[model samples]
Target: MMLRVFVTLKPSVLDPQGMTIQKTLAGLGYSQVEEVRQGKYFEIRWAGDLSAREERDKVETIVARVLSNPVIEGYRIEWPQEIPA
Candidate 1:
């Protein structure tokens, strides 16, 4: 199975990179842009027999321990509807 993880800074945390990008966009004539928030995307492929619940648990552990910073970051997992042939 394939899984995707998205990690982003919590709303309360300041995002300097995002701000910079937003400013750049505005300078580039994208005046309508209000804000930009940056995040990380990870695609993982697991070939195991683990059940759905177990897989979720394992992925959550990985995300919490290594994929994202618990202090100021939040993460979510996505399961694609169709696997590539």
Candidate 2:
């Protein structure tokens, strides 16, 4: 199975890097660009034979425990041909 993880700061948290990128874009004539937020992306390819439900459980656990900080960051996972709950 192939999975994608996206980790980003929560809306309540401040992102100085995103702010800097936005400001730089504006200065570079990207006037239409309003805001920017930086994030982390991870791709995982698993060769396990687990079913979808099992795979989801394992992946969610990994994401929650290792991939993201729960306090100030949020994460989303993309499962192969499926919508995450």
Candidate 3:
């Protein structure tokens, strides 16, 4: 049982950092990459007693309330999956 929170900017909003990276890539001759957008990624580890659905909901609640700005940003939870051994 773990909790994960993923926060990202809304699609309509501009991501300056992503734009810079894309430009830099093009300068390096990587023209095949047409579009690039950046967002946040995080992996959180919490207790093991909570169910997957419960954990996701918990994160969702937090994201909606505080972690994410619904007007300018979005958030989603990651489901349980195998960890590398």
Candidate 4:
């Protein structure tokens, strides 16, 4: 199964990189742009026979322990859905 994790800074935290990008965009004539919050996305592929709940638990553990910093960042996990042929 494939999973995706998105990590981002907490709302109260200041994002200098995002601000810089926003300013650059404005300078580039993208005046309508308001704010940009940068984040990280991870795509993980796990091959196993684990059940859905088990897989979700494993991914959650990985996200909490390895992927994100609990103090300043937040993360969300997305489970893959089957695609019809």
Identify the candidate with maximal lDDT.
Answer: 2
Worst 10 residues of 3 by lDDT: 76-85
lDDT measured at residue 59 in model 1 versus the true structure, 0 to 100: 73
Show model 1 residue runs off by greater than 4 Å: 80-85
lDDT of 3: 0.73
Estimated TM-score per prediction? Answer: 0.87, 0.87, 0.73, 0.87
For candidate 2, the per-residue lDDT at 4 reads 88
Q: In candidate 3, which residue pairs get closer than 3 Å at backbone N, Cα or C atoms, i.e. clash? A: none
Residue 76 in model 2: lDDT: 93
Question: For model 2, what is the C-alpha lDDT against the true structure?
Answer: 0.87
In candidate 4, the residue pairs with backbone N, CA or C atoms under 3 Å apart (3 or more residues apart, or in different chains) clash, namely: none
Q: lDDT per residue, candidate 4, 1-85, as tens digits? A: 7777899999999999999999999999999989999999999888853355676677788898899999999998776765211
| C-alpha lDDT of residue 25 in model 4 | 100
- In order, what lDDT does every prediction score? 0.86, 0.87, 0.73, 0.84
How many clashing residue pairs are found in candidate 4?
0
